[model samples]
Target: MSAITLEIDGNKVQVTDGMTVLEAADNAGIFIPTLCHHDKLEPFGGCRLCIVEVEERGWTKMVVSCVYLAAEGLVVRTRSDKVDRIRKTILELLLAHAPDAEVLKELAQEYGADKDRFEKDPSFCIHCGLCVRYCAEVKQKFAVGFVDRGIRKEISFIPEIAARECNACKECFPLCPTSYLQAAFVLTESLAFPAQQKKSE
Candidate 1:
Protein backbone atom coordinates (compact mmCIF):
# COMPACT_ATOMS: atom_id res chain seq x y z
CA MET A 1 0.00 0.00 0.00
CA SER A 2 1.28 3.41 -0.94
CA ALA A 3 1.53 6.13 1.70
CA ILE A 4 -1.15 8.81 1.70
CA THR A 5 -0.60 12.06 3.45
CA LEU A 6 -3.42 13.99 5.06
CA GLU A 7 -3.99 16.55 7.75
CA ILE A 8 -6.05 15.87 10.82
CA ASP A 9 -6.77 18.56 13.39
CA GLY A 10 -3.93 20.57 11.81
CA ASN A 11 -1.45 17.75 12.33
CA LYS A 12 0.10 16.12 9.29
CA VAL A 13 -0.49 12.37 9.10
CA GLN A 14 0.84 9.74 6.76
CA VAL A 15 -1.15 6.58 6.31
CA THR A 16 -1.28 3.76 3.83
CA ASP A 17 -3.85 3.35 1.11
CA GLY A 18 -7.25 1.92 2.04
CA MET A 19 -6.96 3.35 5.55
CA THR A 20 -10.00 5.16 6.89
CA VAL A 21 -9.85 8.69 8.21
CA LEU A 22 -10.37 7.37 11.72
CA GLU A 23 -7.39 5.02 11.43
CA ALA A 24 -5.26 7.85 10.13
CA ALA A 25 -6.34 9.99 13.04
CA ASP A 26 -5.50 7.17 15.43
CA ASN A 27 -2.06 6.73 13.93
CA ALA A 28 -1.46 10.45 14.39
CA GLY A 29 -2.69 10.37 17.96
CA ILE A 30 -5.68 12.59 17.14
CA PHE A 31 -8.61 11.73 19.34
CA ILE A 32 -11.85 11.35 17.41
CA PRO A 33 -14.58 9.99 19.61
CA THR A 34 -16.36 6.89 18.32
CA LEU A 35 -18.59 4.17 19.76
CA CYS A 36 -19.09 1.84 16.82
CA HIS A 37 -15.44 1.46 15.84
CA HIS A 38 -13.22 -1.28 17.25
CA ASP A 39 -9.70 -2.11 16.16
CA LYS A 40 -10.40 -5.83 15.88
CA LEU A 41 -13.62 -5.45 13.92
CA GLU A 42 -14.42 -3.96 10.55
CA PRO A 43 -15.48 -0.32 10.58
CA PHE A 44 -19.10 0.04 11.57
CA GLY A 45 -20.51 3.56 11.45
CA GLY A 46 -23.58 2.73 13.50
CA CYS A 47 -22.81 5.58 15.88
CA ARG A 48 -22.15 8.73 13.92
CA LEU A 49 -20.07 10.17 16.71
CA CYS A 50 -16.85 9.99 14.66
CA ILE A 51 -18.21 12.34 12.04
CA VAL A 52 -15.66 14.83 10.74
CA GLU A 53 -15.54 17.69 8.32
CA VAL A 54 -13.33 16.86 5.33
CA GLU A 55 -12.15 19.70 3.15
CA GLU A 56 -10.68 18.68 -0.13
CA ARG A 57 -10.32 21.17 -3.01
CA GLY A 58 -12.12 23.85 -0.96
CA TRP A 59 -15.37 21.94 -0.64
CA THR A 60 -16.07 20.95 2.92
CA LYS A 61 -18.34 18.00 3.62
CA MET A 62 -19.06 15.82 6.63
CA VAL A 63 -18.25 12.11 6.61
CA VAL A 64 -18.12 9.34 9.15
CA SER A 65 -14.43 8.97 9.87
CA CYS A 66 -14.55 5.29 10.72
CA VAL A 67 -15.62 4.28 7.21
CA TYR A 68 -14.51 7.21 5.10
CA LEU A 69 -11.32 6.39 3.23
CA ALA A 70 -8.41 8.67 3.88
CA ALA A 71 -7.10 10.35 0.75
CA GLU A 72 -4.03 12.31 -0.14
CA GLY A 73 -4.25 16.06 0.46
CA LEU A 74 -7.41 15.66 2.45
CA VAL A 75 -7.95 18.18 5.24
CA VAL A 76 -9.88 16.61 8.07
CA ARG A 77 -11.23 18.61 10.96
CA THR A 78 -12.19 16.22 13.72
CA ARG A 79 -13.86 18.89 15.78
CA SER A 80 -15.51 22.19 14.87
CA ASP A 81 -18.61 24.12 15.77
CA LYS A 82 -20.61 22.35 13.09
CA VAL A 83 -19.18 18.94 13.92
CA ASP A 84 -19.79 19.55 17.62
CA ARG A 85 -23.39 20.51 16.95
CA ILE A 86 -23.95 17.36 14.91
CA ARG A 87 -22.34 15.18 17.57
CA LYS A 88 -24.46 16.83 20.24
CA THR A 89 -27.60 16.03 18.29
CA ILE A 90 -26.55 12.41 17.63
CA LEU A 91 -25.64 11.99 21.29
CA GLU A 92 -29.05 13.35 22.25
CA LEU A 93 -30.78 10.77 20.08
CA LEU A 94 -28.65 7.94 21.46
CA LEU A 95 -29.08 9.28 24.99
CA ALA A 96 -32.82 8.93 24.60
CA HIS A 97 -32.31 5.19 24.29
CA ALA A 98 -29.65 4.72 26.96
CA PRO A 99 -29.98 7.76 29.17
CA ASP A 100 -27.69 6.43 31.89
CA ALA A 101 -24.97 5.17 29.55
CA GLU A 102 -21.79 6.63 30.99
CA VAL A 103 -20.08 6.89 27.60
CA LEU A 104 -22.95 8.91 26.18
CA LYS A 105 -23.08 11.12 29.25
CA GLU A 106 -19.37 11.88 29.06
CA LEU A 107 -19.53 12.64 25.35
CA ALA A 108 -22.69 14.65 25.94
CA GLN A 109 -20.83 16.80 28.43
CA GLU A 110 -18.09 17.47 25.92
CA TYR A 111 -20.57 18.30 23.16
CA GLY A 112 -23.10 20.03 25.42
CA ALA A 113 -25.81 17.52 24.64
CA ASP A 114 -28.73 17.51 27.04
CA LYS A 115 -29.52 13.95 28.04
CA ASP A 116 -33.08 15.08 28.53
CA ARG A 117 -33.19 16.82 25.16
CA PHE A 118 -35.35 14.04 23.86
CA GLU A 119 -38.02 11.96 25.54
CA LYS A 120 -36.73 8.70 26.95
CA ASP A 121 -37.43 5.72 24.77
CA PRO A 122 -34.95 3.59 26.74
CA SER A 123 -34.55 0.29 24.94
CA PHE A 124 -31.24 0.47 26.80
CA CYS A 125 -29.24 -0.49 23.71
CA ILE A 126 -27.60 2.25 21.67
CA HIS A 127 -27.12 -0.21 18.77
CA CYS A 128 -23.39 0.28 18.62
CA GLY A 129 -23.08 -3.36 17.36
CA LEU A 130 -19.82 -3.85 19.19
CA CYS A 131 -20.92 -7.10 20.73
CA VAL A 132 -22.47 -8.43 17.56
CA ARG A 133 -19.45 -7.65 15.42
CA TYR A 134 -16.91 -8.74 17.98
CA CYS A 135 -18.62 -12.05 18.50
CA ALA A 136 -18.98 -12.75 14.80
CA GLU A 137 -15.77 -11.30 13.44
CA VAL A 138 -13.21 -11.73 16.18
CA LYS A 139 -14.48 -14.71 18.11
CA GLN A 140 -16.00 -16.44 15.09
CA LYS A 141 -19.00 -17.18 17.26
CA PHE A 142 -22.33 -15.77 16.20
CA ALA A 143 -23.67 -15.73 19.70
CA VAL A 144 -25.12 -12.24 19.97
CA GLY A 145 -26.83 -10.30 17.23
CA PHE A 146 -29.45 -7.68 16.50
CA VAL A 147 -33.10 -8.48 16.10
CA ASP A 148 -35.91 -6.56 14.40
CA ARG A 149 -35.31 -3.45 12.33
CA GLY A 150 -35.22 0.34 12.44
CA ILE A 151 -36.62 1.69 15.71
CA ARG A 152 -37.51 -1.76 16.99
CA LYS A 153 -33.98 -3.11 16.66
CA GLU A 154 -32.44 -4.65 19.76
CA ILE A 155 -29.60 -7.01 20.68
CA SER A 156 -30.18 -10.58 21.72
CA PHE A 157 -27.99 -13.52 22.56
CA ILE A 158 -28.44 -16.81 20.76
CA PRO A 159 -29.52 -19.31 23.40
CA GLU A 160 -27.65 -22.37 22.18
CA ILE A 161 -24.61 -20.57 20.80
CA ALA A 162 -24.54 -18.24 23.77
CA ALA A 163 -25.03 -21.15 26.06
CA ARG A 164 -22.02 -22.98 24.64
CA GLU A 165 -19.83 -20.20 23.19
CA CYS A 166 -20.78 -17.13 25.16
CA ASN A 167 -20.55 -18.74 28.56
CA ALA A 168 -16.81 -18.96 28.17
CA CYS A 169 -16.28 -16.17 25.64
CA LYS A 170 -17.93 -13.13 27.13
CA GLU A 171 -15.36 -10.78 25.63
CA CYS A 172 -17.97 -8.68 23.88
CA PHE A 173 -19.74 -7.83 27.12
CA PRO A 174 -17.15 -5.29 28.21
CA LEU A 175 -17.14 -3.79 24.72
CA CYS A 176 -20.64 -2.47 25.33
CA PRO A 177 -20.54 1.25 25.95
CA THR A 178 -23.90 1.31 27.67
CA SER A 179 -22.69 0.55 31.14
CA TYR A 180 -25.20 -1.21 33.37
CA LEU A 181 -27.53 -1.43 30.41
CA GLN A 182 -30.59 -2.91 32.04
CA ALA A 183 -29.27 -6.39 32.97
CA ALA A 184 -26.24 -6.27 30.67
CA PHE A 185 -23.81 -5.56 33.48
CA VAL A 186 -23.20 -9.34 33.68
CA LEU A 187 -23.55 -12.49 31.61
CA THR A 188 -27.17 -12.70 32.68
CA GLU A 189 -28.00 -10.26 29.84
CA SER A 190 -28.37 -13.39 27.74
CA LEU A 191 -31.34 -14.25 29.91
CA ALA A 192 -32.77 -10.73 29.78
CA PHE A 193 -33.64 -10.91 26.09
CA PRO A 194 -35.04 -14.39 25.82
CA ALA A 195 -37.59 -13.04 23.40
CA GLN A 196 -35.29 -13.00 20.37
CA GLN A 197 -32.11 -14.92 21.21
CA LYS A 198 -32.02 -16.39 17.80
CA LYS A 199 -31.23 -19.40 15.51
CA SER A 200 -30.34 -21.50 18.51
CA GLU A 201 -33.78 -22.98 18.93
Candidate 2:
Protein backbone atom coordinates (compact mmCIF):
# COMPACT_ATOMS: atom_id res chain seq x y z
CA MET A 1 0.00 0.00 0.00
CA SER A 2 1.15 3.53 -0.71
CA ALA A 3 2.04 5.93 2.09
CA ILE A 4 0.83 9.44 2.79
CA THR A 5 3.00 12.05 4.46
CA LEU A 6 1.32 14.55 6.75
CA GLU A 7 2.32 17.15 9.31
CA ILE A 8 0.67 16.52 12.69
CA ASP A 9 1.37 19.08 15.40
CA GLY A 10 4.40 20.19 13.39
CA ASN A 11 5.72 16.63 13.40
CA LYS A 12 6.28 14.92 10.07
CA VAL A 13 4.59 11.53 10.03
CA GLN A 14 4.01 9.02 7.27
CA VAL A 15 1.06 6.66 7.37
CA THR A 16 -0.45 4.16 5.02
CA ASP A 17 -2.82 5.60 2.49
CA GLY A 18 -6.50 5.72 3.51
CA MET A 19 -5.52 6.01 7.21
CA THR A 20 -7.35 8.64 9.18
CA VAL A 21 -5.66 11.50 10.96
CA LEU A 22 -6.36 9.82 14.29
CA GLU A 23 -4.61 6.64 13.10
CA ALA A 24 -1.62 8.66 11.92
CA ALA A 25 -1.46 10.46 15.23
CA ASP A 26 -1.51 7.14 17.02
CA ASN A 27 1.38 5.94 14.93
CA ALA A 28 3.31 9.13 15.52
CA GLY A 29 2.70 9.02 19.30
CA ILE A 30 0.49 12.11 19.21
CA PHE A 31 -2.63 11.76 21.30
CA ILE A 32 -5.98 12.95 19.98
CA PRO A 33 -9.00 12.92 22.26
CA THR A 34 -12.08 10.99 21.06
CA LEU A 35 -15.29 9.58 22.47
CA CYS A 36 -17.52 8.17 19.72
CA HIS A 37 -14.63 6.41 17.96
CA HIS A 38 -13.47 2.86 18.59
CA ASP A 39 -10.64 0.97 16.95
CA LYS A 40 -12.69 -2.22 16.64
CA LEU A 41 -15.53 -0.51 14.78
CA GLU A 42 -15.76 1.75 11.75
CA PRO A 43 -15.61 5.48 12.29
CA PHE A 44 -19.14 6.89 12.57
CA GLY A 45 -18.11 10.57 12.94
CA GLY A 46 -20.98 11.04 15.37
CA CYS A 47 -19.02 12.94 17.99
CA ARG A 48 -17.09 16.06 17.11
CA LEU A 49 -14.71 15.61 20.05
CA CYS A 50 -11.91 14.42 17.78
CA ILE A 51 -12.07 17.59 15.77
CA VAL A 52 -8.76 18.86 14.43
CA GLU A 53 -7.77 21.91 12.48
CA VAL A 54 -6.82 20.82 8.96
CA GLU A 55 -5.39 23.02 6.24
CA GLU A 56 -7.60 22.37 3.28
CA ARG A 57 -7.95 24.57 0.16
CA GLY A 58 -5.77 27.21 1.84
CA TRP A 59 -8.22 27.45 4.77
CA THR A 60 -7.98 25.77 8.16
CA LYS A 61 -11.21 24.12 9.27
CA MET A 62 -12.15 21.88 12.14
CA VAL A 63 -12.71 18.31 11.02
CA VAL A 64 -13.29 15.06 12.81
CA SER A 65 -9.96 13.27 12.59
CA CYS A 66 -11.43 9.80 12.96
CA VAL A 67 -13.29 10.00 9.67
CA TYR A 68 -11.02 12.34 7.71
CA LEU A 69 -8.42 10.42 5.77
CA ALA A 70 -4.90 11.75 5.85
CA ALA A 71 -3.47 12.86 2.49
CA GLU A 72 -0.06 13.85 1.24
CA GLY A 73 1.11 17.24 2.45
CA LEU A 74 -1.90 17.54 4.74
CA VAL A 75 -1.31 19.80 7.74
CA VAL A 76 -3.19 18.66 10.85
CA ARG A 77 -3.16 20.38 14.23
CA THR A 78 -4.33 18.07 16.98
CA ARG A 79 -3.70 20.44 19.86
CA SER A 80 -4.10 24.17 19.90
CA ASP A 81 -5.80 26.71 22.13
CA LYS A 82 -8.85 26.78 19.85
CA VAL A 83 -8.99 23.01 19.55
CA ASP A 84 -8.61 22.54 23.31
CA ARG A 85 -11.39 25.01 24.06
CA ILE A 86 -13.72 23.34 21.61
CA ARG A 87 -12.96 19.90 23.01
CA LYS A 88 -13.54 21.13 26.56
CA THR A 89 -16.87 22.62 25.58
CA ILE A 90 -17.95 19.44 23.88
CA LEU A 91 -16.99 17.40 26.96
CA GLU A 92 -18.83 19.79 29.23
CA LEU A 93 -21.95 19.57 27.11
CA LEU A 94 -21.87 15.81 27.07
CA LEU A 95 -21.30 15.73 30.84
CA ALA A 96 -24.23 18.03 31.52
CA HIS A 97 -26.48 15.79 29.46
CA ALA A 98 -25.25 12.66 31.22
CA PRO A 99 -23.90 13.62 34.63
CA ASP A 100 -23.98 10.08 35.95
CA ALA A 101 -22.12 8.83 32.92
CA GLU A 102 -18.73 7.77 34.32
CA VAL A 103 -16.97 7.71 30.99
CA LEU A 104 -18.19 11.21 30.17
CA LYS A 105 -17.17 12.47 33.58
CA GLU A 106 -13.70 11.01 33.19
CA LEU A 107 -13.30 12.65 29.81
CA ALA A 108 -14.40 15.99 31.21
CA GLN A 109 -11.97 15.72 34.06
CA GLU A 110 -9.21 14.78 31.68
CA TYR A 111 -9.71 18.04 29.80
CA GLY A 112 -9.80 20.04 33.06
CA ALA A 113 -13.38 21.06 32.41
CA ASP A 114 -14.90 22.19 35.69
CA LYS A 115 -18.05 23.92 34.55
CA ASP A 116 -20.99 22.92 32.37
CA ARG A 117 -22.42 25.92 30.59
CA PHE A 118 -25.30 24.01 29.08
CA GLU A 119 -28.51 23.12 30.89
CA LYS A 120 -28.50 19.69 32.47
CA ASP A 121 -30.73 16.99 31.07
CA PRO A 122 -31.73 14.04 33.24
CA SER A 123 -32.00 11.65 30.31
CA PHE A 124 -28.67 9.89 29.71
CA CYS A 125 -27.18 8.46 26.52
CA ILE A 126 -25.09 10.80 24.39
CA HIS A 127 -26.35 8.88 21.33
CA CYS A 128 -22.85 7.77 20.30
CA GLY A 129 -24.43 4.47 19.05
CA LEU A 130 -21.46 2.38 20.17
CA CYS A 131 -23.77 -0.14 21.78
CA VAL A 132 -26.06 -0.38 18.76
CA ARG A 133 -23.15 -0.66 16.33
CA TYR A 134 -21.35 -3.28 18.40
CA CYS A 135 -24.45 -5.42 18.75
CA ALA A 136 -25.46 -5.36 15.12
CA GLU A 137 -22.09 -5.34 13.39
CA VAL A 138 -19.66 -7.04 15.78
CA LYS A 139 -21.83 -9.38 17.82
CA GLN A 140 -24.18 -10.20 14.95
CA LYS A 141 -27.14 -9.62 17.26
CA PHE A 142 -29.70 -7.15 16.10
CA ALA A 143 -31.59 -7.53 19.33
CA VAL A 144 -31.31 -3.91 20.31
CA GLY A 145 -32.26 -0.83 18.29
CA PHE A 146 -32.68 2.85 18.95
CA VAL A 147 -36.24 3.93 19.51
CA ASP A 148 -37.63 7.39 18.88
CA ARG A 149 -35.62 10.13 17.18
CA GLY A 150 -33.39 12.99 18.26
CA ILE A 151 -33.51 13.65 22.02
CA ARG A 152 -35.92 10.82 22.71
CA LYS A 153 -33.83 8.15 21.03
CA GLU A 154 -32.47 5.32 23.22
CA ILE A 155 -31.25 1.73 22.88
CA SER A 156 -33.39 -1.20 24.03
CA PHE A 157 -33.82 -4.83 23.23
CA ILE A 158 -36.72 -6.10 21.21
CA PRO A 159 -40.08 -6.80 22.95
CA GLU A 160 -38.73 -4.63 25.83
CA ILE A 161 -39.48 -7.51 28.23
CA ALA A 162 -39.70 -10.99 26.75
CA ALA A 163 -36.46 -12.60 27.92
CA ARG A 164 -34.47 -9.83 26.23
CA GLU A 165 -33.30 -10.79 22.75
CA CYS A 166 -29.84 -9.96 24.21
CA ASN A 167 -28.87 -13.67 24.52
CA ALA A 168 -27.13 -12.63 27.80
CA CYS A 169 -23.89 -12.53 25.85
CA LYS A 170 -22.85 -9.35 27.70
CA GLU A 171 -21.22 -8.08 24.53
CA CYS A 172 -23.24 -4.91 24.09
CA PHE A 173 -22.94 -3.91 27.74
CA PRO A 174 -19.13 -3.80 27.65
CA LEU A 175 -18.94 -2.00 24.30
CA CYS A 176 -21.10 0.86 25.60
CA PRO A 177 -18.88 3.92 26.00
CA THR A 178 -21.04 5.16 28.86
CA SER A 179 -21.42 3.22 32.12
CA TYR A 180 -25.23 3.07 31.91
CA LEU A 181 -25.57 -0.54 30.72
CA GLN A 182 -22.75 -1.98 32.84
CA ALA A 183 -23.90 -0.21 36.03
CA ALA A 184 -27.46 -1.38 35.49
CA PHE A 185 -26.29 -4.96 35.07
CA VAL A 186 -24.32 -4.85 38.31
CA LEU A 187 -27.28 -3.39 40.20
CA THR A 188 -29.64 -5.96 38.75
CA GLU A 189 -27.40 -8.88 39.60
CA SER A 190 -26.99 -7.63 43.17
CA LEU A 191 -30.76 -7.31 43.64
CA ALA A 192 -31.69 -10.56 41.89
CA PHE A 193 -29.15 -12.78 43.63
CA PRO A 194 -28.74 -11.89 47.27
CA ALA A 195 -25.35 -12.84 48.69
CA GLN A 196 -26.79 -13.99 52.04
CA GLN A 197 -28.82 -17.18 51.94
CA LYS A 198 -31.88 -17.69 54.13
CA LYS A 199 -31.91 -20.42 56.75
CA SER A 200 -33.73 -23.55 55.57
CA GLU A 201 -36.27 -25.28 57.81
Candidate 3:
Protein backbone atom coordinates (compact mmCIF):
# COMPACT_ATOMS: atom_id res chain seq x y z
CA MET A 1 0.00 0.00 0.00
CA SER A 2 1.30 3.42 -0.86
CA ALA A 3 1.96 5.74 2.04
CA ILE A 4 -0.20 8.85 2.39
CA THR A 5 1.05 11.90 4.23
CA LEU A 6 -1.27 13.97 6.42
CA GLU A 7 -0.81 16.59 9.08
CA ILE A 8 -2.15 15.64 12.49
CA ASP A 9 -1.98 18.04 15.38
CA GLY A 10 0.60 20.05 13.44
CA ASN A 11 2.81 16.98 12.93
CA LYS A 12 3.29 15.37 9.55
CA VAL A 13 2.30 11.71 9.63
CA GLN A 14 2.78 9.22 6.86
CA VAL A 15 0.50 6.22 6.98
CA THR A 16 -0.49 3.43 4.64
CA ASP A 17 -3.47 3.87 2.37
CA GLY A 18 -6.92 3.01 3.75
CA MET A 19 -5.89 4.18 7.25
CA THR A 20 -8.42 6.23 9.15
CA VAL A 21 -7.61 9.60 10.64
CA LEU A 22 -7.54 8.01 14.08
CA GLU A 23 -5.07 5.37 12.95
CA ALA A 24 -2.89 8.03 11.38
CA ALA A 25 -3.02 10.12 14.52
CA ASP A 26 -2.15 7.05 16.56
CA ASN A 27 0.77 6.29 14.26
CA ALA A 28 1.99 9.84 14.89
CA GLY A 29 1.61 9.48 18.69
CA ILE A 30 -1.36 11.81 18.91
CA PHE A 31 -3.98 10.93 21.50
CA ILE A 32 -7.59 10.91 20.32
CA PRO A 33 -10.13 9.63 22.80
CA THR A 34 -12.49 6.88 21.70
CA LEU A 35 -14.77 4.28 23.30
CA CYS A 36 -16.58 2.38 20.58
CA HIS A 37 -13.32 1.70 18.77
CA HIS A 38 -11.01 -1.26 19.28
CA ASP A 39 -8.12 -2.13 17.04
CA LYS A 40 -9.39 -5.68 16.84
CA LEU A 41 -12.85 -4.62 15.71
CA GLU A 42 -14.22 -2.48 12.90
CA PRO A 43 -14.90 1.16 13.75
CA PHE A 44 -18.52 1.56 14.88
CA GLY A 45 -18.44 5.22 15.90
CA GLY A 46 -21.05 4.59 18.57
CA CYS A 47 -19.58 6.77 21.30
CA ARG A 48 -18.74 9.79 19.14
CA LEU A 49 -15.85 10.55 21.48
CA CYS A 50 -13.05 10.80 18.95
CA ILE A 51 -14.42 13.82 17.11
CA VAL A 52 -11.72 15.96 15.56
CA GLU A 53 -11.60 19.07 13.45
CA VAL A 54 -10.50 18.56 9.86
CA GLU A 55 -9.96 21.04 7.07
CA GLU A 56 -11.76 19.72 4.01
CA ARG A 57 -12.34 21.72 0.84
CA GLY A 58 -11.45 24.91 2.68
CA TRP A 59 -14.09 24.21 5.29
CA THR A 60 -13.14 23.08 8.80
CA LYS A 61 -15.61 20.49 10.04
CA MET A 62 -15.82 18.17 12.99
CA VAL A 63 -15.55 14.50 12.15
CA VAL A 64 -15.02 11.33 14.11
CA SER A 65 -11.44 10.28 13.51
CA CYS A 66 -12.06 6.58 13.96
CA VAL A 67 -14.17 6.43 10.79
CA TYR A 68 -12.74 9.30 8.79
CA LEU A 69 -10.19 8.15 6.25
CA ALA A 70 -6.86 9.95 6.25
CA ALA A 71 -5.99 11.63 2.96
CA GLU A 72 -2.94 13.30 1.51
CA GLY A 73 -2.60 17.01 2.31
CA LEU A 74 -5.39 16.71 4.89
CA VAL A 75 -4.95 18.94 7.93
CA VAL A 76 -6.35 17.50 11.13
CA ARG A 77 -6.65 19.01 14.56
CA THR A 78 -7.14 16.41 17.24
CA ARG A 79 -7.65 18.89 20.01
CA SER A 80 -9.36 22.24 19.87
CA ASP A 81 -11.99 24.18 21.80
CA LYS A 82 -14.76 22.75 19.59
CA VAL A 83 -13.32 19.24 19.64
CA ASP A 84 -12.77 19.41 23.40
CA ARG A 85 -16.34 20.49 24.00
CA ILE A 86 -17.69 17.67 21.85
CA ARG A 87 -15.44 15.06 23.47
CA LYS A 88 -16.23 16.24 27.00
CA THR A 89 -19.93 15.97 26.26
CA ILE A 90 -19.51 12.48 24.92
CA LEU A 91 -17.40 11.51 27.93
CA GLU A 92 -20.04 12.81 30.29
CA LEU A 93 -22.62 10.62 28.51
CA LEU A 94 -20.36 7.58 28.69
CA LEU A 95 -19.67 8.14 32.39
CA ALA A 96 -23.39 7.95 33.05
CA HIS A 97 -23.27 4.36 31.82
CA ALA A 98 -19.73 3.26 32.72
CA PRO A 99 -18.93 5.31 35.77
CA ASP A 100 -16.74 2.58 37.26
CA ALA A 101 -14.80 2.01 34.07
CA GLU A 102 -11.23 3.07 34.83
CA VAL A 103 -10.60 3.73 31.17
CA LEU A 104 -13.58 6.02 30.96
CA LYS A 105 -12.69 7.70 34.24
CA GLU A 106 -9.14 8.40 33.16
CA LEU A 107 -10.19 9.70 29.77
CA ALA A 108 -12.87 11.82 31.37
CA GLN A 109 -10.30 13.34 33.69
CA GLU A 110 -7.93 14.02 30.81
CA TYR A 111 -10.65 15.80 28.85
CA GLY A 112 -12.07 17.56 31.90
CA ALA A 113 -15.45 15.92 31.51
CA ASP A 114 -17.98 16.58 34.22
CA LYS A 115 -18.89 13.37 35.95
CA ASP A 116 -22.07 14.92 37.28
CA ARG A 117 -23.10 16.71 34.15
CA PHE A 118 -25.77 14.14 33.44
CA GLU A 119 -28.09 12.40 35.86
CA LYS A 120 -26.80 9.12 37.21
CA ASP A 121 -28.17 6.16 35.30
CA PRO A 122 -28.45 2.70 36.78
CA SER A 123 -27.18 1.04 33.63
CA PHE A 124 -23.48 0.30 33.65
CA CYS A 125 -22.88 -0.72 30.05
CA ILE A 126 -21.93 2.11 27.76
CA HIS A 127 -23.46 0.08 24.91
CA CYS A 128 -20.39 0.66 22.78
CA GLY A 129 -21.30 -2.68 21.10
CA LEU A 130 -17.78 -4.00 21.48
CA CYS A 131 -19.03 -7.23 22.98
CA VAL A 132 -21.80 -7.59 20.45
CA ARG A 133 -19.47 -6.92 17.52
CA TYR A 134 -16.80 -9.18 18.94
CA CYS A 135 -19.26 -12.00 19.42
CA ALA A 136 -20.72 -11.72 15.95
CA GLU A 137 -17.73 -10.63 13.89
CA VAL A 138 -14.80 -12.36 15.58
CA LYS A 139 -16.38 -15.15 17.58
CA GLN A 140 -19.18 -15.84 15.09
CA LYS A 141 -21.50 -16.81 17.93
CA PHE A 142 -24.24 -14.19 17.47
CA ALA A 143 -25.36 -15.04 20.96
CA VAL A 144 -26.24 -11.51 21.96
CA GLY A 145 -27.80 -8.51 20.27
CA PHE A 146 -28.88 -4.96 20.88
CA VAL A 147 -32.60 -4.60 21.42
CA ASP A 148 -34.70 -1.45 21.26
CA ARG A 149 -33.56 1.94 20.01
CA GLY A 150 -31.82 5.02 21.33
CA ILE A 151 -31.86 5.20 25.16
CA ARG A 152 -33.85 2.01 25.33
CA LYS A 153 -31.28 0.02 23.39
CA GLU A 154 -29.48 -2.69 25.35
CA ILE A 155 -27.62 -5.95 25.01
CA SER A 156 -29.92 -8.92 25.39
CA PHE A 157 -28.73 -12.48 25.44
CA ILE A 158 -30.76 -14.90 23.36
CA PRO A 159 -31.33 -17.54 26.02
CA GLU A 160 -31.36 -20.56 23.71
CA ILE A 161 -28.23 -19.57 21.81
CA ALA A 162 -26.46 -17.94 24.74
CA ALA A 163 -27.06 -20.83 27.11
CA ARG A 164 -25.85 -23.26 24.55
CA GLU A 165 -22.78 -21.33 23.45
CA CYS A 166 -21.83 -18.64 25.97
CA ASN A 167 -21.00 -21.13 28.72
CA ALA A 168 -18.44 -22.87 26.56
CA CYS A 169 -16.98 -19.68 25.17
CA LYS A 170 -16.67 -16.55 27.26
CA GLU A 171 -14.62 -14.98 24.48
CA CYS A 172 -16.40 -11.64 24.64
CA PHE A 173 -15.67 -11.12 28.34
CA PRO A 174 -12.42 -9.24 27.92
CA LEU A 175 -13.85 -6.99 25.22
CA CYS A 176 -16.46 -5.41 27.43
CA PRO A 177 -15.57 -1.92 28.68
CA THR A 178 -17.69 -2.27 31.83
CA SER A 179 -18.27 -4.84 34.58
CA TYR A 180 -21.81 -5.57 33.43
CA LEU A 181 -20.68 -8.42 31.20
CA GLN A 182 -18.54 -9.91 33.98
CA ALA A 183 -21.45 -9.74 36.38
CA ALA A 184 -23.71 -11.30 33.78
CA PHE A 185 -21.25 -14.09 33.20
CA VAL A 186 -21.00 -14.83 36.90
CA LEU A 187 -24.76 -14.84 37.21
CA THR A 188 -25.10 -17.17 34.26
CA GLU A 189 -22.50 -19.56 35.64
CA SER A 190 -24.08 -19.59 39.09
CA LEU A 191 -27.45 -20.32 37.60
CA ALA A 192 -26.02 -23.03 35.39
CA PHE A 193 -24.17 -24.76 38.24
CA PRO A 194 -26.11 -24.23 41.38
CA ALA A 195 -24.50 -27.40 42.74
CA GLN A 196 -21.04 -25.89 42.23
CA GLN A 197 -22.18 -22.66 43.86
CA LYS A 198 -23.42 -24.57 46.91
CA LYS A 199 -20.26 -26.68 47.06
CA SER A 200 -18.07 -23.59 46.95
CA GLU A 201 -19.99 -22.02 49.82
What 10-residue stretch in candidate 3 is worst by lDDT? 191-200
Tens-place lDDT digits, model 3, residues 50-126: 89999967889999889999998899998899998888888898888778788888988888998888998958878
Among residues 3 or more apart in sequence or in different chains, the pairs in candidate 1 whose N, CA or C atoms overlap within 3 Å are none
Q: Judged by lDDT against the true structure, how good is candidate 3?
A: 0.84
Ranking by TM-score: 1, 3, 2
In order of appearance, the predictions have TM-scores of 0.90, 0.83, 0.89
Go through the candidates in order and give the clash count of each.
0, 0, 0
Task: State each model's CA lDDT, in order.
Answer: 0.85, 0.76, 0.84
- As a whole number from 0 to 100, the lDDT of residue 98 in candidate 3 is 73
How displaced is residue 36 in candidate 3, in Å?
1.5
What lDDT score goes with residue 67 in model 1? 95
- Cα error, residue 94 of model 1, in Å, equals 0.8
Cα shift from native, residue 92, model 1 (Å)? 0.7
- Residue pairs in candidate 3 whose N, alpha carbon or C atoms collide under 3 angstroms: none
What 10-residue stretch in candidate 1 is worst by lDDT?
Answer: 180-189
The best candidate in terms of lDDT: 1
Q: Model 1 segments beyond 4 Å from truth?
A: 180-201
Over the stretch 1-201, how does candidate 2's per-residue lDDT look in tens digits?
A: 898899999999999998999999999999887767887889998778999999966889899999999999999998888888889988888877677677777777877775456788855677787877877788766655678988777665553321343435777676666666555444444454323212111
Higher-ranked by TM-score: 2 or 3? 3
- After superposition, candidate 3 runs with Cα above 4 Å error: 187-201
Ranking by lDDT: 1, 3, 2
